[model samples]
Every structure is written in C-alpha cells, then in structure tokens.
Target: MELTVDERWDLIDKISKQTITFGRYSHTLKDAIAEITVKPLTGIPIAIAVMYGFWSFFGAFAGFFTDGFFVKIFDEHWLPWLQKVFPGEGGFLYYILVGDPTADNCFEAFGMLTSGLFVAIGVVLPAIIAFYLFLIIMEDSGYLPRLAVLIDTILHKIGLHGFAIVPIVLSLGCNVPAVTATRTLETKKQRFMMATLLAIFIPCGAQLGMMIEIIPGYVGFVMLYLLIGFFVTGFVLNKIIPGRSPEILMDVPPYRMPTVRNIGRKMWMRVKGFLFVAIPFVMLGVLLVNVLYWWGVIDWLADILEPVLSAWFGVPKETVGPLLAAFLRKDLAIAQLSAIEMTTYQLITSVVLINLYFPCVATFAMILKEGKEGGCKSAPIFLLGSLATLVATVFLFGGLLHLIWIILGVA
Candidate 1:
C-alpha cells in the first residue's frame, strides 16, 4: 500500500511477464515449429528443402494438367474444330489466328487458339495454380517470415534487409505487385535496388511454369542461374549505389492452422487473376507477335538484332521476337521460345536473358511510379543502367554455366 513508483512499475512488469509466459506456453505447437524453423543452423536448410519440394510438386502438377489433359483436348478437339470451321489453313487470317495447321505440335503451330490458348490455359495456368497453392500454404502456416529470418544475414550482405524478402517472394508470383510492395522498404536506394533485382532475376510464376513445361528437366538449372544472377547483381548494386541498408524490423506472427475458408478465398483471388487478367494478356501477346510477324516487323527486328542474338547470346535470330515479346509479358515470351529449334544451351541462355533483361509492362510502370514517389529524380537513368548491367551479367553468367555444363559433359 505504501510502495514507491519504481516498485509498483517492477511489480507490473513481473505480472506482464507471467501473463506472456502463460500465453506462449498455451501454443506449444507454434513454439515447437519455431524452434526448428528459426534456429540459425537448421533454418536455412529447411527453407531450401521446402522450396525444392514446392518446385517439384509444381512441375509434376503442371505437367499433369498441361501434357495429360489440356494438350489432348486442344489437339483432339479444339484444333480440329477450328480447322474445320475456318477452312483456309493457308490463308492470311487462318495463318494469323491458327498458325500452321501442318505443324507437329500445338507449340509449333503458333496460333491464337492453338499455341496461345494451350500455353495460357494448359501450361501457365496449371503452374500458377500450383504456385499459388503452395504460396498460400506458406503464408497461412507462417513459414515465409521464418524464411526471411533465415536469409536475413545473407540479404544484408547483399544490401537488402530481411523485409526485402517479401517483394522477392511476391515477385515470384508477379513482379507488378512486387514492385508496388517496394513501398514497404524504408529508403529510396533499397526500393530501387530491390526493384532492379526483382525485374532482372526473379522469374514470375507464369514464366517459371512455362520454363518447366518447355525445358522439362532443365528448369532447376535455369532457376539456379537466375538466382546466381540475382545475388551477383545485388552485390554489385550494393557497391555502386550509395545508400545504407536499413535493418529489418518486422513482427513474426503466430502460426495457426489455416482456415479452409481463408485459403479458398486467397486461392480464388489468385486463380481468378490468372484466368482473366493473365490469360487475356497472353492472348494479346500472341496476337501482337503474329501481327508483327505477318507485317515483317519481326523479321526486320530479327535482322537488326541478329548479330547480338546469334553471336552474343548464342541463340538464333528468331529469338529476337520472343525477347521483344518479353516486354509485353514474360510468360508469353517463354512460350514463344518453345517454337524455336535450338540447342539446350541456347534455350537455357535465352531463358536467363529474358528473365534478366526487363520486367513486363505492368511491372515496369510500377517501378517507375515507386521510383518517383520515393523521390528518385533519376529513376529512368537508374533503370537503364540496371538493365544494361543485367544484360551483361546474364550473358556472362549464362556463358559460364554453359561452359561448365559442357566440361561436365552435361550440355
């Protein structure tokens, strides 16, 4: 009753500690999971293992949907029906819409309903579903934050804080929102660096899905190459860009069993986006590419960029079309790459380059907006410089990887 202020404050703190202890002890499962996931020694390895599982499942699931189901329907029903209705297979409109009916596969038959729909619905959509499902699970289960914690030291060495991992992970889903999310970063430098890294190296789920479909056994290698590029570019930018990386100060929420309703709602939002927004853009990309081809624009561009494409990148001149298409949509660009007949090395090289070159149109706009809002007056200059650096880095990295593969007798 006669206690001083300091004594009363001490008593209050003790009671608060007791309350917190009881609350924490009540969530035994959450604490147990955290003990493993947040420990320095085991955390990184576990995160890698989880990521590997995600990719493996994504590949298998997407493959089942694309090759087993969608391809069959497209080949057996959609293509034949379209050919019957629009009989002039060799006509200009038919060629533009349906591609070459005589082509062996839907991928080679570069038509809107044929190759485009097949890619968007069959290949990319399935991959998107798998990715979002996995991502949703991670988000619900609270593993993603632990992943950030696990990688925070490495990220800091490369000039990013742990919080940057949010955008990095989001970029895997889609770069536009990822770029928008850069607002969560504290400094202009961090945002710019993060955005640059994302645009350059993080292949969106759609693109990754297409890579999985097209390259089959080689998607992992491609991803590895891009990840290396990401770190290398980030390190270089950290040195070149003049700014201090802020420390990551974030709250790690409690782990809980994800409610089915919440998971379903989140999954539906992402799936709806893929079905409506992404698919239409993919079709538009296909149509635009075909129009450019018929108008001889693609040929002109290919000829103009032939030396760089063929000599520098080790890809054919036809790759210029897909490279250009990457600006519109990266997934569509990868789909277009499927039509080209090239060596595996060249295919890998092209995929690396596309991923490192630039973001899609939407992401590009978001980067600009974010830059301006963050008071970066020289946003365009920074972006151009970043693009130039990325181009050089990817070419060098791809060549080195190919050389190593050749030496190992894998190429």
Candidate 2:
C-alpha cells in the first residue's frame, strides 16, 4: 500500500532529526545535508575563504623560490657564461650560439627564446607548481560545489546556473583545465557560455605570476579594475547572447581532511601535465624568436605591429616580442616585458592586454571540447568573443592610462 502524504512528511521530519555518530562528531546525515545545502551563503563563504588561503600561501611559496633560488643563482651566474660561450657578435654560429642574431651581449638574448630557459625555469615552473597545488587542494576539499550554491542567485541573473562556477573558478588556474571541467555541466547552452567567457578573460596561472612580479605597485590597482571590467562584460554578454539558465542540482561532498599523499600526487600530476606541453613550446618559441632576430624579421614585424602596439596600446615597440610569444606561453610574455622600457602606465596597460588576450594553445583545445559537448556547434563565437575582448581590453586599459597620464601631466 502507498504511504499517505502526511506519513511521508512525518518520516522526513523524523529522519532529519535522527542522530548518528561518526568519529568525534555526531549528526544525522539528513540534517547535515540540509544545513549545508540550504544555507548557500554560509557554505559559499567558507569555500571562498579556503580558496583564498590556498592561493595566498602558494603565492608566497612560489615567490620564495623565484626570488631566493632562481633569480639569485641562475640569472646571476649561469646565464652570463652561457652567453660568453655562444658569443653572437659576428658569424652565423654566433647567432645560434649567443641566442640572438643581432646582439653581441647575453642580456639581449634574455629577451629572445634562447636564453629563455632561465625565464621558464626561474619564473614559470615555480609559479605553475604553486598554482596547481592550490587548485588541487580546492578540488579535493569539495568546496567548489558549495561556491556554486552561494553564487547561484547571482549567476541565474547572469543567464547561468550555479554550476557555471566550476569552469570560472578553474579558469584561474588555467583555462584549459577549466574548459575541460565544463563537461560536468548538464546543458549545452551553459557550456558554450562558460567556454566563451573562460577563453576571453580568465588569466591563467602563468599570466598571473607575471602580473604579480612585473605590474608596478600603483598599477596593481588598475589590474583590479580590469578584473571588474571582465565580470561586468561577462554579465552584459550573458543577457545579449541568447541562453537559458540551467537549474542547480549538485552533490555537496562532505568536508574531509585530504590525505597528504593524495594532494601531493594530484599537484605533481597537474604541474607535470603543464610542463609536458609548455616545455616544447618554450623551446620552439625560443628558436623562432632567435631566428627572426637573425633574419631581420623581428624588426620588420615590430615595425608593422608598432601602429597597433605602440599607438593604440601605449606600450613600447619592443613589447611586440613578448606579445608575440604570449600565444605560445604567457610566462614568456611577462618575462619579455621586463626587457622593455616603459612608464608605469604603459606597463599596466600592456600587462592587462596580455592577460586578456588569446589563451594558450592547450586552453583552446579544452574550450573546443567543452563547446562540442555542450552541443554548441559554432566554434567561431567562442573565438570571436576572446579576440573581441582582447582588443577591447587593450583599448580600455590604454585609454584609462592615457587619461590618467594627461591628468597628472606625465604624458
């Protein structure tokens, strides 16, 4: 016989109140679920707080290695000798040897792909490892799901469900992984919208590390403003672009202490994955940049890129080198910026544009996968969205700096 509605209600209430003990705590599973799932604000804040803590720790840890080890030891001693051996002053071998075709000195090769080994090892490796460490912890903690619940209402207004939080948060670590994670979502519309946004605005770990180092103190404020612009633009796009918000229904895994071994393994796996892809690109990019310098291609390309690069972006013509390398590896882009001379305003604008522009190649593949899974057949929309955001961000940040410079009489 079927139970009456009143009987079901009574049973639920009883279950909710029933007590069970596990380890040092005791609570009914039903009641625990209610407390976590129903209180969106509480759970969300806890999740975000944990995430902030993790990243802050990572930043400090990575900065230690970059400054204490790589910068102090590698850049100070090893690079100088390598430059002497390669000696790129006269012959064709010198061009390949010194890492730069046009330069007699080693420092110039620091900007080219040859001496870029120092850049990759000194800056990118430590930072990427730290970022993945934080990312993996967040994943294991099961906090990301609760974050979705917390932001569900706001996300709904933006034409997305709470689950969209997964991709957006992951994009901070790297848009590639975030795009891949979009498969967890139930709807195609949700996936496409998220993929476009991730590719367009999310600064991956490598780009972020560059910003932390190269962006001057005051202009760091402007970087914050740029993030505001990212969110605002995304919100507006969510409305103008057609899509239905998916309903939120997700598992809130219990909070448990993640095993040390598990966290270490996960973090290492992510770092290794990135290195496997990044190392090849780093070598190829170095070779390409060095060859271009030897062939006069860099100067020619700089001349062509100068109109947009210097005039519109307010960055020096030299910045074109790093900007070209940005597609190959963002860390190199940031490192290249260090080789150029620019005012604080120009530096901020360039950094903002670099962070906002085209995602790395690995990220593109993940985005395409997300798009296909979501049943959004048109890939051009995601590509165009990313490119448009790039152009708009460059103009916006550059214009903001121009106004500031004029106001201060620094222009």
Candidate 3:
C-alpha cells in the first residue's frame, strides 16, 4: 500500500536517522566570492570594475580591428579599387554604388559597396563581438544574478525589478531582443516601462560601435546623457503610470566557470543575428539615402526642416539625410552623421536625437508583436504607451540638451 504523506515523511526520517550521516557543510571559495560580490558595498564596486573592464575590452578590440586592420583594407585598398573599376564614375549608378570617386576613406565614400560594407563588416561586427563575448562570459559565470540583486533597489524606484537590467543590458546589444525580453517583467507596468525606456534611451551595440568609430571621445558623454534620460523618464513613468510595482523573488544561480563551447555558441548566434539583421539594413539605408538625395527629396525636406532643426535643435540642415536614415538604421545614420560637417555639440545633439527619435523597423515590429501577448495591458495600450514615451523623451531630452548647450555657449 502507498504510504500517506506524513507516514512517508516519518519513514524517510527514520531511515535517514538510522542510515544517513549529516555533515556540517563547508562554505567554498565560490560561496565566499558570491557572498562578497552580492553585498552592497562590495558588489557595487565590483560591478563598476567589471563594467569598466567590459568597456575597455570593447574599445580596444573594436578599435584594433576597425583602425589597425579594416581601415587599411577598406579605405586604402577597397575604395580605390572600386573607384577605379566601377563604370560611370560620376553617374547616378556609380554614385549610388561606389560613392564619391575622390573620397579617400570608406566613411566619406557613402556608397553601398564602400561605407555600407565597411561599417557593417569592419566596425559594428567587432564591437558586437567584444560586447557579447564579455557578456556571455559574465552570464555563464553566474555574476549576472548578483548584479541584478545589487542594482535592484535603484531599479525598484524606477518601477523595474533589478532583473530589469537584463533587458537594458541586452538592449546594449540590440533592441529587438530587448523588447522581447521585457516579457520577463512580472507586471504589465514594469514590462511597458522597461520596453519604452530601452527603445528611447538605449543605443544598440551596432550603434555604439559606430559611435566608437565616429566619436569615441564623446561616446561616454552621450551614453551618460542617455543614462540620465533613462532614469528620469523611468521615474516619471513609475510615478504617473497606473499599475502595481511589485517585488520579485530572485533565484540567484551558483557561480560556475564559463566554458569555451558555450561562449563560442552564444557569441556565434549573436554575431550571426547581427550580420543577417544588420548588413541588409546598412545597405538599404545607404541605397535609400542616396536615392532620396538623388531625387531631391532630401534637399526639399532640408529647406522645410532647416529652420526648425537649426532653431530648436542647434543641428545643421545636412542632418536631414541622417535623421531620415535613423529610422532605418541608427548605426548607419550615425555613420552618415559623422560625414556631415558640424561642431562637436551639434554632432552630439544630432546623434542623441537620432537615437531618441525612433526605433528601427525590426524593433518596432517586435514591440507590436510582443505587446499583443502578455498581461493586463492590451496591444493598443502597449503600442501607444511606448509611442507616447518616445515622443515625450525625444522632445524633452532633445530640447533640454539644446538648451544646455546654449547655456554653456557651445551651440
């Protein structure tokens, strides 16, 4: 006969009492490290150090590839070869494909075959590799959960659980998956808030890579500004949005050494995603921007937009093309932004606006797709919420930045 629950437990207890010897468990080195890393005073500094290492590695790896190696391959060898061999040197087809015959660097070339390929293959590819490599290592090592715990209190004030940092971190790589990741949030309010904040404020790895390529010195400033915007907007949304910001129980996993196979697999998948999703967009962005320029649409819009952009944003009219391209690919838009002549302040403002203005098409689609599935809010609420957040963030943050520059006499 099957024993009842109490009887079974009693029998198991008797058996354990008779047969099993209980030993005092010893705390291992991993346990000690975990304890140290999760505590507030220790963990925060460790987290900061880890992030600094991540940043240094990313910069060094991407710079070494883009500057040391690919710059030579693309700018010196590839551009000249294409400029010489491509037919109809000054014709529309030639201009669209090979860009400026006289331009020395791939960036200035602005062609599908030149800048598009170089930016996608050389610049962004390396950045994402470095980013994901380190991220995967951290993830596999089990430090991410401790990080989530450490950052939890700050995130709670913004209506997100500490684990919400996952999506934010992921958004650093790409927003499409980051938007999907919002589903991990327990509450509708949390998910919506996280998604909105990320799409508006977080630049993708490719975009960061391009920023590194174009404005490495100012990337830190831009990221800091965006971080401020993220928190500020999140605070407002938390206070105003009607919903429960509930506490979540975290399941922190044990620390383990990262294996090469797992790291390689995850990194390959991420880089592959970057390649397939990104390269086509880069090519398309170049093609479309060129077409718009060729058709006089850019010039037409520039005339209409110049007054508003110049007066309100302190950016130049030449930014119209990049702004248009930003919707297609923010990284490509920044690459294009770099080609335009502007002061450091204007470039900064323009790049920030480009990042804040809109989500790329893939990310937009993910928002629409992911919004329909979960929780208290319906799709309309989700979509409109994100759009509203984007609108307020872009104008408030964008206009405020311009005002700051003006105050500093930088504009």
Candidate 4:
C-alpha cells in the first residue's frame, strides 16, 4: 500500500491542504507592548522614563526612611545615650566607640559604633532595600530585557553587549555581586573591562546614599561627573582592549504583573547579604582610621601628601584618613569626610575622589576572583593593569575637575 517517496509526499500534501484550517490570529496587548518597547524610537523614551521613575522612587523611599525616621533615632536618642553612659569620658575606648562626648549627632561622632552602625543600618540599608526592590520589580515584570535591547548598541561602543548592563546596574547596588555578574559576558575582554571600570568609576548604593544624605545639593553634579567619566573611560578602553564587541539579540518577553512574594524574597536576600558586607567593613573602617589617627600615622601621611593634594586636587590633606577608609567601604569614607571642615566645592571634590580612589575590600577580592578566569590576560597582569589605569584616571579626571573649579573660581 506504500507508494514511492515522491508520490507519498504528493498525496500527503494534497490531504493536508484539505484537512488543515488556516485562520487569522489577533495580536494581544502584550504583543503590542513587546513590539514598542523593543523598537528604538519608542523604547528609548520609555527607558528614560523608567529610569527617571526608578531614581525618583529610590530617593523618596530611602530619604523617607533614612531621614524622617533613622536620622532622628540615631542622632538624638542613641548617640546622646551612648556618649553619656559609656565610661572613660576622656579615654581611648570611649573615643573609639562613643566618639566625641560633646558631639550631639551621629554624623559628627566618627566612632566605630555610632557612625558605623548609623551608616550601615540607618542610611545605606534603606537605600539598598529601595534600590533592590525597584530592580527586582523591573526584572520580574520583564522590563529588564527591553532595557538591555534598548541600550545594546551604545554599550557596544564600550566593548560590552546588552547583557553587560546586568553587571553595570548591579554594580550600583554592590560591586561584589556585580563583578560576579561579569561571568555572563561572552569574552574575557568584556569581563575585565566591565569589572575594572565599574570598580573604579561606579559608586555603590551605600556611597550614593551617603552622598545624598550629606551633600544633597551637590549629589547630582557629582553623579553627572562620574557618569561622564564612566562612558569616556569605557570608550577609550574599548578602543585599546583586544576583543570583539559582538551584538546581542535578546528576547523581549511579554509583560506580566510581578508577584509581591518574589519581589520581597529577592529584596530580603540581597539586603541580608549587604548587611553582612556593609556592617563589618564600616566597623573596620572606623577601627582602622581611629587606630591610624591614634597612632599619628594619618597626620604624618597628611603632612607628607599635603603639598601634592593642595596643589593638584585642591582638597584638604585631612582627607588622607577618609581616603584610606574608602578602601574598606566608600560609604564609611564619605561619612568620615563629612565630619571634616571643608568648603562646599571641596566636599564635592572629596566625594568624587573617594569614589575614584579605590574599590572596597569585598569588591577588590571579588574582582581578583573573577579576573583570574580571563583567558586573554593573567590575573596578576589584570590587577596591575587595572591599578595603573586607576592611578592615571584619578590624576587625569580628578585634576580635570580641580582645573574646572579653578576656572569657575570655585577652587
């Protein structure tokens, strides 16, 4: 009953035509949204709006919780009680733990427990929670893919594809995870560039939170400067680093309502991880700075570095301690910097310097870990190369700001 191959195929085609029904399918709203969000013209504007909303929410939520609630608790109730109750009014332990006995607020206290706990729990934690919440919502709701597609071309200019945006955004929250996220990159070159640039350029959420709290007026300008440095440096690195900045085709999934349970779970897990890293480093920063200051090392270094700092960067030499603390945690360094007496412009410059000075301890270890996997470059070479690039960038960019300030009569 079986016919030859060609005859059987011809019979099947004839039968299929008669049996199968063809009909027009309607495009749903989800499909329409998917189309517009992936297209460049519509997607770019929407992406901008999304980011604007993200920032707005982050500021409002973090500010409300940090300023309206925690600031009061830390500054008024906790600090005064600690200052009064702790023994050894003029002794070392008192100074290290309770800070200035006469100081009225946590910001000026500059002690291991007072400022460290306040920055880690009160200020940075709120910002971390808010940032991760917004990010998770975007992820579960399916907007992240579109964002990746939207920015793919621009990112390619920096030797990264669209997916590279994951690490870039994550770096804003914490560089440790962000460095890990670089594994998703297709090549070692992209990983090295992304990790190194992020470590040097992008200030983490903790640092950003402190910036907002301490210098609300100047935060925007500082951020703009850093962002410009990020792209300009990225573009330059893309040119020199050997790699193929390949294009990516990402799927734009249909939008759906993100579940509250998933959002809460992810936010909690991230914040928990952050607390472990943030609290210890913040405490360590206070301990090291206090010990070094107690030992007069900071003073010696300040005296030695003064002429160069004053002449080149236009910041006070007192920033030497804060600069050292910046290696442990940038948020801690920024808090320390706020206690020092400085002009507004100097504060802005110092903040920028703290950002560009060095990556935190955790981030440094993470970079070292992820960097070794680079097939193109050895880990030691990567570390050395990154340090050299960082030194060059700090001098060039920091001095450029100093020069601009001089021109504007603000230096």
Candidate 5:
C-alpha cells in the first residue's frame, strides 16, 4: 500500500504550497501597510522637509555670490569692458555680446547676459548641487524602495507602480537623470509610462529655480497649483492608458547613513556632469537664439507660432525664444523666462508649460536607450503621449485662468 514516487512528490508539493501560505501570508500584509504609510505620509514629508532645509541653506549660500559677489563681477569687469570693447556699434555681435543694457530692448548692454549668468551660476548651481546631493543620499541610503512601496497604489493608477518614484523624484533634480533612472524599472511599458510622465510634468532644478526668481511673492500658491497639476494629469494618465501596473519588486538596500566620502563624490560627479553636459547646451542655446534673432528667422518663426502661443497660452510671441531653447535644455527655458516681464499667472503658466514642454535632448536620448533596452516596439507612444498631455494641460489651464481673470479682473 506504499505510495509510488510520483504520488510522494505530489504530496510534498501540496504540503510545500500550504506551508508557504502559512508562513508568508501575515508578513505580506504587514509589509504592505508599512510600505504604504511610509511613502505617502512620513517619507514624503521628510523628503519635503529635507528639500526645504537644503534649499534654504543653499539659497543663502548662492545668494551671497548672486547678490554680492556676482554683482561685483558685473560692476567691476564684465560690464565696463564689454561696453568699451563693443562701443556703440549697433550690430548683431554687439547685441549678442552685450544684451540691451538699459533695460530696454533696443540698446546694447551687458545687463541681461550678466543677470542670466548670475542666475545660472550663483542661484541655479547651488540649488542644483544641494538638490542632487539630497537625491543621491536618498537613493543610496535605500529609502527609495520604501518610497516606491509607499506610493505604489497611486503610481499604479497611472500604469506604473512605486518604483516609478526614482525617476519622478530625480526629475526634480534634472529630467536627464530621471529619464536615465528608468533603467531601474523592469518592463518597457513601465519605463515608457514613467518617462512620459516625467517629461511632461516634472520640472527640473533649473526650471524650479527660475520660477523661484520670477514667481514673485506667491511662490507657495504657484507651487500648490503645480502639485495639483501633477496629480491631476497623472491620475488622468492612469485612467486613459490601458495596462496593468508592473509588479513592484524593488530591492531595499540596507538603511545606512550615506558616508561623507560617498556623498561628496556623488555630489561632485553630479555637479561635474551637469556642468559638462548642461552648460554647453545653455551657451549654445543662447548663441543659437541670438543668431536666429539676428538673422530674422526667430521673428518669422515666432510670427508663425504667435497665434497659438498668444491666444491659447496667453504667452507673448517672445516666448518662442525660450521655447526654442527648451528643446536643448529644460532649465534654460525656465531661466530664459526670467529675462521677460510676466504677470504672476503668466509666470505660473510659463513654468508649467515649460515643464510640460518638449523633452530635453538628454531625455530624448534616454528614451531611445530605454526603448532599446526594454524591448519596447511601441516607443514612440511615449513621445506622442507626452506631447499630447503637455498641449492639453497648457490649453486647459490657460482657458481656466483666462476665465478666472475674466471673473476676477486682474485685481
């Protein structure tokens, strides 16, 4: 009456399955509760507080240079020499080298260029460094996995899962790295979904830093609007796209404080990478826009784009200059907005539009890389979807604000 070998194995398999259920069922529920609570409540708040503290300190440090030190540089050397060297010859070179100094458009002066650099180096750089440092610390310390687990439910609604946090969070520092971080996602669908969201809605450090400059006295309110936009657009994307949220099996690396050496090296590498890659694009964007303007191509292009930009978005024709730069670098677009005068609504809209605008060259490359790596045959969907979202958001928000203005009468 002894069982055969096959019968014995079947008995073992059944017992194993039951044993697994008995052993792991409680652990699963406990882990779920722990991950979710940490992500939305405590984890997110800690991240925000860390962000505020880092920025507050970084701003004070950057302000010293931007307000005091860079001012001296402009006053002492850059402005006087540029004026002497360029000297009253009203040509394109004069205009490019020394932007209208008198705060008027027609005159050739060094103020705009100086102001732009100070904004770029003194303000943007410090914030960028500090922000990137915080991100690296979070990433290496392994809190990111819990963050992913915590937000999995919300992210799932958008065809992604908790792991998408890596890219979305990094997008705050820079879309380029955020896009690259998509490599951590297992499936092509997840990467594409996350990448599309990152490009359309996430403002990089430069963009946010620029908004800090121009948003003017209501930064808090503008930020709240942006947060609302992110969640709304993300929620809509979840409903519209047909896909299951990928399994969230992130590796929770051990929670240890990031070492000083490791943190310094990480920050240095990120800063160096930013400068090497981003600065050239910024300078080139500046050069290209100036050349295009000088040659009248920019004007022609702006004329063609004017109706859509002005009527729909309520942005001026001059915005086309910054939009052109946006394709090269998202930060540059935001930084460029500072040169122009915009109402608070216009400022917020411009920030949102620029954020939701075209992906940078780096992000485009990352998208292509991810497509290749993830075996996604339908990669173009991300690009198209992102563009659609950006256009829709701009128009929708623009219309809403226009109605609000009509109702409110600009106070």
Candidate 6:
C-alpha cells in the first residue's frame, strides 16, 4: 500500500514529534548564534571583525616573541658567539655564512645561520603559530562554514560559489594542498580559475608570517591591498572567463567548544612542516643569493632589468634577486626583500608583486598535476600564460598603488 506524498510527510512529522523533544525552550545557544551568523546583514561584518581580530592578535603575538625574546637572544648572545667562532673578517665563506657581520641586526646581516635562522624561527614561526591557533579555533567552532554561507552571494559575483571557500581557506595554509583540493569542485573551469587565483593572490602562512615580521606597521595595509586585488581580479576573471558558477550546497556543523588537544595536535603538525620544509628553503635561498652575488650574476640581471624594476615597479634594481627567489619560496623571497632597506612604498609594491607573481615550485607542480588530471591537458601552457598575465597585472597594480600613495603624500 503506497502512501500519497502528503500522507508520507504527515507520517514522518508524527514520527519526528514522537522521537524528538526539547525541555520547554524552543532554541539553544548554538541555534541563536547560527541564526545571526548565517544572515546577510550581520554575517559579513562579524566575519570582518573576526578576521581583523585574528590579524591583530597575530601581529601582537608574533611581535612579542620576536622582539621580546628571539631578537634579544640571537643578537645579544648567539650571533656574537657564531661570529667570534667563525671569524673571517673579509673572506668569501664569511660573506656567504654571515652577511655584513657588523650589521646591527640579524635581518640586516643576511647570514645563513643568522638571517636564515632568525627569519625561520624568530620572525615567521611566531606568526605561523598565531595563525594556526586562530584557524583551528574557527574550524573546531564551526564558524568557518557559516562564514562561507554568508559570503556565498558575494562569491558568486567573483566566478565562484561558497564551496570554493574550502580551497581558498586551505590555500592560506599552503598552496600545494589547496591546488589538490580543487578536485572537490565539479567543473574544470572552476578548478582552473580557483587554482589560478590561489596562485596569484593568496600568500601562504609562511609568507604572511614573515611579511608581518618584516613590514611591521605596514603589514595590515599590504594585506588589505592584496585582498582588494583578489576581489578585483576575481571580478575581471568572471567577466572574461566563459562559465557559470554553481550554487553552494553545504551542511554546516554545530558549534562547540574546541578541544584543546586537537587544536594542539593540528598546530604542531603544521608548525613541524614549516620548520622542516621552510628552513631548508630559506637556507638554500641565502646560499643561492650569496653565490649569485659573488658570481656577479645578480648585478648583471639587476642592470638588465633596471628599466622595469626601478622605473616601472618603483623598487630598487637589486629587487631582481628577490623576485627570482619568490618562485622557489615566497617566505625566503620576503626575507630577502627585508634586507634591502627600501622605502615603505617600495616595500609595499614589492610585496604585492611577489604575491601576484607566481606560486612556489611545489604549488606550481600541483597546479600542473591537477590541471592534467582534471582534463586540462594544456595546463602547462595555460599556467605559463596566466603567470605572464599576472606579472603584467601586478606591475600595473603596484605602479598604481605607488602613484596613489605619492598623490596622497604618504610615500
């Protein structure tokens, strides 16, 4: 005996009524919070407030560790001992290991053991810790899913739906896994577009951490500018790219107090990866830069690109080396830039360009792999073309930002 659809629903309603009960109250605390966080009017502002708090805390927390502790220990004790032990007043090995040994700070020294370790442990690690802590809290509390829901309409305007937020969030951790996460999207177009945007706009945790340490007061402004660039680039891509963005269909989990053990475990894993992966790359970058400098190749390239680097980007000619290093590791690239002693405007422009230039080697390979597996067999050509376009776009954007700053008398 088949029941009518109305009868089926009526029976299910009766079953639910019998099975479920709430003591007097109609709603729980979680329900009330969800009601506010999923709404259009209040959700976006709350999201912004939360993000601002995250960064604010990140800046302070990292600064406390860096200036209050790491810098003091390294500069006052470790660096001096290392310098004394490896005293080579003007030798080639000395220059490579401890750059400009007499500089006031490790960052300025640009040494393998000094600047390299200082950047990884002193500067970047603290910021990474802060970011992961906040990220874990949000993830376990279920705020991220609601934030995604709240931004669904806005995302549609940018050629992606709320579902794309998963990869976007993941990209903040590292772009390689973010690229791999693109497989979750249904369409090839979305996968390609998201992968492209992630590579161009999102600064991974390590890069952001180092930027916060190096740029000091201007890190917030630089980040805001990059975010604006992300949205504008997305809007333009939506207009140019020929595809329809699918609507989001996601199940939001219930809010709960995050487990301390889980958060610690996750943070440890991420920090461990950063320590092992990022430190080697940073040390390699220092070695590579010193080698290139000794060989005079950096000077030759700087001379060749002086027209573009200096006249166009408003940065020093030596920025060519950092720009090249950005492809291998963005944190190292930013670390390299910190040693250059440029004006605030130049630093901001260089940071923006490095973010928009290209993905690190790992992410680049992941993009190619994902593109091929996702059926875009011409992924290599497409990535190269996208990279070229990004470089041109960033250069223009950087110049415009510098011009605006100058017009406002801030430069």
- lDDT (tens digit, per residue) of candidate 5 on 239-276: 77776555766666556668899988988898888678
* lDDT measured at residue 290 in model 5 versus the true structure, 0 to 100: 73
Please identify model 3 stretches exceeding 4 Å from their true place: 1-22, 375-377
As a whole number from 0 to 100, the lDDT of residue 318 in candidate 4 is 98
Q: Which stretches of candidate 6 lie over 4 Å from their true place?
A: 1-25, 409-411
TM-score of every candidate relative to the true structure: 0.90, 0.82, 0.94, 0.92, 0.80, 0.90
TM-score of 2: 0.82
Clashing pairs in 2: 86-97, 113-286
Model 3 sits at a Cα RMSD from the real structure of 2.8
* Tens digit of per-residue lDDT, candidate 1, span 1-87: 588999999999999887865423464766878888888888778888998898788888988898899989988888877777877
Better of 3 and 4 by TM-score: 3
Q: In model 2, where do residues sit more than 4 Å from their true spots?
A: 1-25, 28-52, 87-97, 100-108, 111-114, 216-223, 372-377, 381-401, 404-411
lDDT of each: 0.82, 0.68, 0.91, 0.88, 0.68, 0.83
Candidate maximizing lDDT: 3
Worst 10 residues of 3 by lDDT: 368-377
State each model's C-alpha RMSD to the native.
4.1, 5.2, 2.8, 4.7, 6.2, 3.5
Could you tell me which 10 consecutive residues in candidate 1 have the lowest summed lDDT? 20-29
Candidate 6 C-alpha lDDT tens digits along 305-400: 999877767788988888888877888788788778688888888888888887888898887787677556667756775677587667768888
lDDT of 6 at 239: 82
Best by TM-score: 3
Supply the global lDDT for candidate 4.
0.88
lDDT string, candidate 3, 1-411, tens digits = 999999999999999899989789998998999999999988899999999999999999999999999999998899999999999988999989998889999998899999999989989899889899988998899988889999999998888889998898889989998999888788888888888889999999999999988888999999999999999999999999999989989999999999999999998898777778788988999999999998999999999998889988889998999999988899899999878889999999998999999899889988888788864459988999899889888888888999999999989
